[model samples]
Target: DQLSKQQSEGDSVIKKLKEELAGEKQRTHQLEDDKMNIIKELTVQKEKLTHSEQALSDLQLTKQKLEDKVEDLVDQLSKSEKNNFDIQKENHELREHIRQNEEELSTVRSELTQSQTQGSSRNVKDDLLKERETQVQNLKQNLSEVEQLNEHLEQVAFDLRTENEELLEAYEEVRNQLEESVAGNKQISLEKTAMLEWEKAPLETELCRAEKRVLEEERKYEQTVQELSSACSPDTSALQLEQERLIQLNQEKDFEIAELKKSIEQMDTDHKRTKETLSSSLEEQKQLTQLINEKEICIVKLKEKSSELQKELDKCAQTLRKNETLRQTIEEKDRSLGSMKEENNHLQEELERLREQQSRVVPAPEPRTLDSTTELESELSQLHRIKGHLEEEIKHHQKMIEDQNQSKLQLLQSLQEQKKELDEFKYQHEQMSISHTRLFLEKDEEIKNL
Candidate 1:
């Protein structure tokens, strides 16, 4: 009964151990599955990390390109602004020049009007002088006709006086003879002599009046001639003074015209130069606008690349977290496996002590020896079965451990690949930064020159 109780107790302990081993095997299988999952997650994380690094590199390259483009745009914009300022200055100068030219033109028009007025006045004066000369010639001809008429009148008067004297001598000789006959016809002869004397007296009075009027007219005409001659003598001097004045005015007008022409020519040259400069400035502005557009495109592309890199980085972080959890589960499984191994070693030591005590207490009788042998045989058979079960459980745990190890190795390899990719991306980013800085410096120098 005691042996039977010991056997039953050992069988119960073996059953408990088997149950524990089964539970530990299940745990180890779960751990192995977790480890495999972890390795897969780690692999996914490494791939994601590699992709993120590539994306980061692309983002950095895009950023650098955008920076360079921005710098170029800034330089172009600055140059365009300077050109605009210069054009504005030129426009202001042109406006000033135009205003001055308009003023000069107005002054020239006024001078021309004055010159035309002076010329018209001089022509009118010349016409008046010509009419006066014609009047003087007509008056001289009338004075000569009056002198001829006075000469004829004086000759007639002399002839009439001689005839009258002869008649008077005849009358004296005939006077004595006439005394004898006078008594008969004296009244009739006296009447005839009275009639003749009356006619002669009236004629003589008319001639004296005509001569007096002619002398008065001659004196008045002579005075008028002397005054006209004096007036005519100064006309030449007056005309010369007028001509000198006109010549001086013409010279002044010519100088002013020359100066105005010179100014106009200079203004035209300046205007042409300004137009050319404005055209060049417009071309530069167009180029600057084009550069700005290109910069904007580069910036958009850079932003897109940055977003993609961030997404990849996020996915890699998620996968890394999953890998960490899996690694912890694998560690727990390994600890459980070690504990089970220690329990198995303790059970083996207890079995060995029990076997040594049984060997020392052997009986000398046949019946007793036979009973002891049979009990020992049964105990040995049970021990062998428990050992076989323990060995099978250990083999299963060992297989799980090997699988975990392989999973761990795969995870490490993936991690190494990800790290190498990250290093490459970092190196590329540093190089880009250096190049971008150099380009920025050059752009700054260009701006200073501008």
Candidate 2:
């Protein structure tokens, strides 16, 4: 009976050992599978880390390039500033030169006036003519200078207008880009936020499931702990292995959570950068607005100057017309003065013949009455007074004619300048038309070829 009892205990112990061995084997197999899965996941994570590192390197390179370009632009801006300074210095020198030219013009005008006054008294007609020609040449030079200054002013206005247009176009482009970037960034942010939120929702659900699984695993672990406490010493190692496996799983979960948190932090940084960029764009927009306003003011000033120039041009035209009319009147006066001189010459000859006749005649023995002698003396005084008046009138007419001739020469010079300007305008128009025609023809030919 004791041997049977011993055999029964042996059988029970052996069965218990077998069951523990089987449970240990099952646990070891499960651990092996878990290890393989962890290894695969680690490899995947490593690959992802490598790709992220490469992308970061590329982004860093791009940032470096952008910084370099910004430096180049700054250097270019400095160079442009120096060029502007040079241009300003040149403009100041040009203004000084113009002032000198004006002084020279004034001096020439005074010399011309003196020469005109002395023309009649000058014995050498040839010298007077040469002097007059020189004066005319000087006046022509002054006119050319004035015209050149006018052209320069016009060119400056054109350049300003073109620059204003270019600035407007650039401002518009920047504004459009800013608006589009804002819209695009907002859209991208919304989409990314939505995507992240959607992903987070799934992750939360999965996390809840993982927590429930963990709870179930904890229950299993507690059951194993209780079983180990109640079981033989041989079962303790299997229970310990199960506990270690659970710990490893928990550590993996924690690593995944940490990765998600890092992604969330990166998203936050991106959102902040977007906000900063938007603020910078707003500042740039404000600057562009101010620039546009300044350009508008400049354009307004240019228009006012153009109007003033037009008024001056009109006044000049009116003066020219007045000069032409005065020239005609002076010519008529010259003809009248010539007629008066001829009449005076005839009267002088008649008076000389009467004097000779009076000398040849015997003394008036018939003795003229005092009344007859008095009448003859009165007529002679009246004729002398008429002759003096005619001489004064002739002198006045000649002076007026001289003045008119000078004015006519000035008007002629102005007319020549106007004609030259007109021709230049016509030539420019023709060039523009020809270029337009060529472009159109090229387009037509291309269309035909197509």
Candidate 3:
């Protein structure tokens, strides 16, 4: 009956473990799906990031070209200003020359008039008239030169006006291009943010659902464990002690699992924050180094946790092997108990035959029969005592086997749990490294561009 009860309990435990395994598998599948979805989103983000970077490069090139154009226009404007100054100076010199010639011509005319009024000799009058005529001819030449200078200056002024108009048009076009580029950059930023938000929403919901499911499973498992502990008999105090320790370990493992989940969530948040910072304006990009440092710290922590989980897995494996050996030992002990029971049955049958033979015997052998019966009774009592001791030992061994099995199961469960956590940690670590590399490259490129 004890064996039957033990088998039933083992079956119940196995069923529970199987149920937990199925649940773990389901959660693993869910995690895989979430991972795939996240990967898809990351891929999309990468494409968009590439596109944005390309667009940014193009915009930067455009801005550079426009800047160069503006600088050239400024140089041209400075040169035009200098040329205007030189032209003005030349015009001033020309005006002064014309004025001096006019004064000379007027003086010459006065002298000629004075000579004519004084009635000087005809030679003197002729000479003065000739000089005045010469002066007038020189004046006419100067006037003609001045008129040509004026026409040249007017042409230069017209050319300057036309060039200024062209420069203004170019400047306006450049300004319009700049405005369009700024608007386009703003639009791209908005689209990027919206896309990120859209992607983040679904992941958050899935994480929430997964957490809820895990919590529900944990509660059920705890309730079942409590029921089993309460149902256990006082004779199994050792088993109970073992169970309590297993429960504590399980609780610790659960806590660790919860911590891992929180860490995963934190990692997601960090990733999102980093991405947002990347998508922010150029000024905010300067903080990327610090963020990368923080991410590195997170990676280090994750590595530590992974190492711890690995150690735990190793320990569980060792314990599982030990439990396997214990199970074999228990089975051997059970066989010994079975053989001893068979011997006891044979002894009981021999005693029964001896009794029947005595009943069939005559009065001539009564004394010998009485002595044989007494000896047989003593031997039977001794056998019964041996059988009782063997039964107790078997019961003790069975309990040990049950405890070993329970521990084995717990170890297996912990192994599975640790394996899952390790996988997730490794995956997240790879993702972080990938993102870090990409971000580092991006920052380098941005710095180079700057």
**lDDT tens digits, residue span 209-287, model 2:** 5446445544654554455445545555754574475456446545644664564455455445544544444454455
lDDT of 1 by residue, 140-243 (tens): 34323323432332343233233323323432333333233222222222332343245335434543443353345335434533443354454556434534
Best model number under TM-score: 3
Show the lowest summed lDDT stretch of 10 residues, model 2. Answer: 119-128
Put the candidates in TM-score order, highest first: 3, 2, 1
Q: What ordering of candidates by lDDT runs from best to worst?
A: 3, 2, 1
Residue range 350-434, candidate 3, lDDT tens digits: 5455456656865665565455445534543553464345345434533443443344344344434534543453454345345
User: lDDT per model, in order?
Assistant: 0.41, 0.44, 0.50
Q: How far does residue 156 in candidate 3 sit from its true spot (Å)?
A: 4.7
TM-score of 2: 0.34
Question: Global lDDT for candidate 3?
Answer: 0.50
- Off-target runs (Cα >4 Å) in candidate 1 are 1-249, 341-345, 348-450
Q: The CA-based lDDT of model 1 is what?
A: 0.41
